[model samples]
Target: MAKDLTVKDVLYALEYMRDALVRTPISDGRARWNMRLTGASVKESVANQVRASGSVSGIEDTGTQIIVWRVAA
Candidate 1:
């Protein structure tokens, strides 16, 4: 079953994930933000978030119907 997640929920998840990486010394990082929405909505929301916060560099649509958000260094 797919999970219904709102824009706020997605953003919160991303923030939490980024906070969790604060201790690690990594050059580049990536995090996957999965949403139950359709492909178009997923793409739109991802783009909005990327524009709102420059932290997100890009997004990838996994063949398994999952959206992956690539965090900028």
Candidate 2:
């Protein structure tokens, strides 16, 4: 059976993934916009959690549970 992820694990995974994304800027702006616009719910959820935790960057959630965090300027 697949290992189940706890809430903490999911959060950490999302954060880590967002950090990794920061290192490489996405090439396709349209695709990025589409993804972001389409996944509003996921982004909002991540953003809410990050905000509650006092994180630096703003989170852009995609509704599919995939989070994209903006690196702090």
lDDT top scorer: 1
Q: In model 1, state the lDDT of residue 13.
A: 48
Q: Estimate each model's TM-score.
A: 0.31, 0.28
Error of 1 at 43 (Å): 8.2
Residue-level lDDT tens digits of model 1 in 1-73: 6555556556554555441111111246533333333221333454355436644434333322222234523
Sequence-dependent TM-score of model 2: 0.28
Best by TM-score: 1
Residues 1-73, candidate 2: write the lDDT tens digits.
5443333543454455443111113555312211233222223344444435534344344422323443422
Worst 10 residues of 1 by lDDT: 18-27
Q: Specify the poorest-scoring 10-residue window by lDDT in model 2.
A: 32-41
